[model samples]
Target: MPHVLIVDDEPRMLELLKLYIQPYGYTCQLVDSAQQALDLCRQHVFDLILLDVMMPDMDGWTCCRLIREHSNIPILMVTARNQREDIIRTREVGANDYISKPIQEGELIGRMEVLLQQQYDGLSYDRESYRCSYLQQKISLTKTEFELLGVFLDSPRRVWTRDQLTTMLWGAEASVDERTIDSHIRHLREKLRVCGFPIEQHLETVRGIGYRWTHQ
Candidate 1:
């Protein structure tokens, strides 16, 4: 069962979201303040977070930034302020998506499903064995290497710039040089090569751009 954290100042809003999501097999946890939401996140792992933008203390934007410092968990910002600038700022502050107030149930559920699927689909890791399933093969990988491969596999064929990979692997606040990305890719490729996967053919580099994972 997927667990979701819903953060809204209004009690009715929290109850409504719970009512809509619980029937769909999602476990919903509600909190009235961003601080409480943050505390819950620290104690438990949630598949997605529905964050309200406006609140009495510690607004959603600040809460999002603080969470992003240590996690890449998907966050969908909900707010009555639907200006273009507000939406852009939400993304800048590390929100995965945004939704305006009075959200449509269908759209909200669809977006949440997409985010959760992207985060969980096509990747299964066995921490005890240090193995990951990818391309129908179970291969061993270092923690860092597995994370990099998981990102590429999650959105196959999508171009990932070095900076984006750095941000996704290490948080935005971490200092990671672009060259370090190349080194990690090199190591990842070596591990894949040992497993008889054609890393060179599938993991292609776009000159002057970044890297992309493609199946031949």
Candidate 2:
């Protein structure tokens, strides 16, 4: 069973989420404040977190940022609005996914499963040999390509802007063109495709923004 941390300021909301999640075999611990949630997170081990955005002491964005500093555990933000800005902010803060308020049980559980599956299945990397494989098949990549993959996998589903990618790949002072990031992504896609993985389906292009690896 997966262990989940459910955080919301509303008592009823926390209970509702717990009810919806527990039936699916996930064990949950509920907290009514972001700070309490953060404190528990530091002291416990959880498979995933269902975090509400409108907490009193600390907003979900700040909580998510703080969590990302030390953990790569899946975080699914629960928010009242589904506005584009909210979605962008969700990614910027490093959440794996988000669900709008008045949450549908099916949608919530499906999203949770996808995030968890993405965390454990389909991909594996060997740090010592610098090798990457999807579904047990090895795919070759150049050093730059390997690092680019690292960035995407580090924060899967987080929208990574070209400026951010450029800075990450080659320091802020380096004169690397933003388009170089695109070229590397293209090459990465080709290699993944050659290995028979559905690279294009999950490694997405955000067009005006950049890229994010997502199960959706």
Residue-wise lDDT of candidate 1 within 61-154, one digit each (tens)? 9999998877667788999978999988988998879989788888899988767654432233444455665444777677889888878765
Model 2 residue 179 lDDT score: 84
Task: Looking at model 2, report the run of 10 residues with the lowest lDDT sum.
Answer: 118-127
Model 1 spans with C-alpha error above 4 angstroms? 121-216
The number of the candidate with the highest lDDT is 2
Tens digit of per-residue lDDT, candidate 2, span 1-216: 678999999999999999999998889999998889888988987878999999886999999999887766789999999999999999999888999989999999999987765553346565557878776677789999988887877676799999999999889998988888989999999998898777877798998999998643
Model 2 residue 172 CA deviation (Å) reads: 55
Q: Lowest summed lDDT over 10 consecutive residues: which window, candidate 1?
A: 119-128
